[model samples]
Target: MDDLRTIIDKTLKQYLNAKQTPFKDNQLANYFRREPKQYIESYIKKTGFHFNYDVKSSVGNGRWAIIPWIVLFDTDISNSATNGIYIAYLFAEDMSKVYLSLMQGWTYYYNEFGTKIGQIKINAALNYWRNSLNLTSSTFSTQDIHLIDPSKRYDTSLPRGYELGNIMSIKYDAGQLPTNQKMEDDLSLMIQSLEELKSKLISTKDIDLSNKYVLSRTNIIKNHKRTPTKRDYDQQS
Candidate 1:
C-alpha cells in the first residue's frame, strides 16, 4: 500500500502533467498547476480576491491527504474573528475517491487577562479556532448552492443547506493513480466545479467577474430564447 504523500503526488501528477498520456493535448491541463501554492496565487490574481491553502499532508499522517483552503471574499473579516468559510478535498479511506466540501466556521472563544481592559475579559475579539459546518453539494444540490441569497441569513436555520452556508462541489475519482480518460473526466469535473464556485463567490461579494468560458450555460440561455410554436408564427404573419 502506498503512503498518502506518494499517492497524492502520483494522483495529482497523472491528473495534470502534460507529459502524461491521458492529459496530453487536453485543455483541462491549462487549469491545473503542479505547484499548488502558485496555482492558488494565480487564481487569486485572476479573480482579485484572497485565496489561501489552509491544510496539507504531514509526515506523521500516512493515511490521510486533506487540503483545505479559505477564500477571503469578505476582505473586512475581523482579524481576531475565528469565523470564515472554506473549501476542501478530502481523500476517502482507501484513497480511491475524494469528497469535495464547502464549509463554514463555528468558532469558540475564552476569557483571558487584558491589561487594557483592567481585568480578565472574554476575548471575543481574539479567535481561538473554528469548527466548520459542512456546506458542500453533499448537503445541497448544485443548482441551489452556487450563489449566496442576499436576503437569506446563512447563519440561521431556515433552509436545510443554507443553515450552514452555500457551496459547490464535484467528486474526483482517480482510481489507484489512474492515468486514463476516467482521470481526465474527473479532473475536468473538478476544475469546472472549482471555477464555478470561484465565480459565484466573487459574484456574491458584489464584484463583477467575467467568466473565462466563452460558451457556457449562461451564455446559451442569454443567446437562445425559447422558440415559439408554428401557430404563433402564423398568427403573427
Candidate 2:
C-alpha cells in the first residue's frame, strides 16, 4: 500500500547492498523471491490479467548467477519461462541497471533447432510479434540488453539465451528509476499490448478462454472486498 516508487527504490538498494553474496540461503536473495516479488504483483494487479512469476539469484542448485531476474508469465500463452513468451525484469551482473523486457522461451527453441538455428527462429518470432502488436511506446527498444558480463565466464547459457530472447525492452538505471506514476503508466502501457496479443492468440487459434486456468486480478479484488455481483460470480465459474 505504500508508494511503488518507494518500494522499487528500496528493493534496488537492497539488491546492491547485498549483491556480492547472493547465496541461496542468504536472506537478501530470498527477499527477491518473497516480499518484493509480492509487492510487484500487488502493484500490477490493476491490470486484471493473471500472471505466474519467479525470481532467481542462481542458475539452479548452488550456482549463483551474475544476472538475476524476476519474470512474469501469462499462462494463457505458456506456463513456463523455458517454453513460452513472457515478460521479465533482468538485473545486470554489476547491479548498475535493470531491463524490463518482453522475451521468449529460448531453451525451447534451442532444444528444437540447436543454438544456431534456434536463434534464427527466435528472431522470426520477435519480428512477427513486433510487427503484429499495437504497442505505441517509442521508448521500448528491440535491439539489445546488457545482462551478460563479458569479463566473467558463465557456467550456464541462460544469460546468453536471455539476451537473445529480447523482443522489446525498457531500461532503468540505478538511482534513475522513474516516479511511481511513471512506472505504473509504463507497466500499464506494456500490459495493453500484451493483452491485445493474448486476445489475438485466442481468436486466431480458437483457444478456449476457459483453458487459461488462472484467476484474474479483478476477481481477486472482488473476492478480497467480500462483495461480488452475480455477473462476477458467473464469470468466475
Candidate 3:
C-alpha cells in the first residue's frame, strides 16, 4: 500500500482544506476514489482472492461522505455496508488515521429485528467471530475503532453502526503509512481471516447477506439478558 500512501495522504489534506463538500467534479476527491481503486484492484488480484472493491469519498452525488472508505467484499457474503460482513479501509472524520477492519453490516439486522434485537444480533455475531477467528496471530487490533465523535448525533446512524460493528482492525496513521511489504503482508492475512468467517457462515442456513440474495429470509438471533452461556455462541448459525 506504499503506492496508496500518496493518494490517501493527499486526499485527506485536500478534504481537510475543502471549503465545501466534495462532489463528482471535484478532481482531487474523485481521484481519491478513482486512482487508488485501481491499485487496490491490482493488489487483490495478486492474492488470487475473488473480491470486489469500492473506493468511496462521498455519498449520493452532492456531498462529501462523513467517512470515506474502501471495501473488499465477496458477493455472496456482502456487496455493501448494508448487510453481512466484509473487510474495509475506513478513514476517520478527524483525518487522524485509517483502519483496515473486518466489520459487520448493521442495517440488515436493524431492518430485520429492529434496533434492540439488531444490536443483540450484532453482539452475538461479534462474540462468535472474535472467538472463531483467533486474531492473535495477526497485527490487527481487537479494540474499538472510532470513526467520528461520540458526542455528536447524526441524522443517519451509519457511522455509529461502523464503530459498534468492528470485530478486529489495524490502525494506520494518515501521515505515516506502512511500507509496501508490510501492506502486502497485511492484505494476505486479511483475506485469509475473512475466509475463516466465510467457512463458519457456510454452516449457517440463514443469513440476510446482501439485499439481493436473502430477499425473504429472517434471522432470529439468540437473546440473552447477561453473559451468554457456552451454547449461546457454540453454533455460529
Candidate 4:
C-alpha cells in the first residue's frame, strides 16, 4: 500500500541523487515506470474502484531530459475518444513538483518549428468535462502546462506538443516535501474528479461525434495541409 506522498518523496530522492542525465538514468527511468504501475494497481485494489486504466512511462530523448513522466489513461474513454485523452502525472526537475494534467492527444505542429495545435478542440473537451462535473471551484493552471503554440517560437528543438485539456499542478520547494496526508488528499481529489469526468464522457451520446470532428479537423491540417516529415513517411511505411 504505497501512498501518493511516498511516491512523490521517492521521485524527489531519485531526482536529487541521480548520477545520470534524464535519458541515460536507468534507475530514475525504472522508478517512473515501476512506481506508477504499483501505485495505480494498489490504489485500485484498496479503493475497490473498477477503472479500466492503462499506465505508460517514458524517459524522453535520454540526453538532456531530466523529467521522467507517467500517464494513466482511462482506456474506456481514451480508446474510444477522438483526441485519445488521458491523465498525466509528471515529476518536474526544477521544483520537484508533481503536475497533474488532462492531455487531449499526441500530435505535433511544424509550420515553422513544432507545437501542439488543438486549442479549440481541447477547450471544448475541457468545457465538457468541467461543466459535466460542475468543477467550478476546481482551478486549472497552465503554469507547467504549455498553453501557447510553440510553433510561433520557430525553435525546432524546443520540445512542445501534448495538448493539455486541463491541468492541476503542485510544486514542492527546495527542502519542502509534501506530507503523506497532503498527497493522499490531493490524489483523492484528482481521482474523484477523473472518475466523474470519465463517467460523463462515456455516457454522453454526442461524445463520439464531437471527438470525430475534432480528430478530423486535426488530421486535415496535419496530413493534408502540412508537409510530411521523414518520420511521418517512415510511420506510414
Compared with the true structure, what per-residue lDDT tens digits does model 2 show for residues 110-167?
Answer: 7655777566656766666677788649888888787867777887788888888887
Taken over the whole model, the C-alpha lDDT of each candidate is 0.31, 0.63, 0.68, 0.52
| Cα-based RMSD of candidate 1 | 19.6
* TM-score for each candidate, following the candidate numbering: 0.30, 0.74, 0.79, 0.63
Error of 4 at 61 (Å): 6.2
Positional deviation of residue 119's Cα in model 4 after best superposition, in angstroms: 2.8
Instruction: List, residue by residue over 31-61, the lDDT tens digit for candidate 4.
Output: 7667777877777677676777777665554
Relative to the true structure, candidate 2 has a C-alpha RMSD (angstroms) of 12.2
Instruction: Give the best candidate by lDDT.
Output: 3
Q: Roughly what TM-score does model 1 have, to 2 decimal places?
A: 0.30
State the lDDT of candidate 3 residue by residue for 28-79, as single tens digits: 6666657666777777777687644443334334677787777777665667
> What overall lDDT, based on C-alpha atoms, would model 1 receive against the true structure?
0.31
- Single out the weakest 10-residue window by summed lDDT for candidate 1: 122-131
What are the RMSD figures for all models against the true structure?
A: 19.6, 12.2, 5.9, 8.0
lDDT of 3 at 193: 88
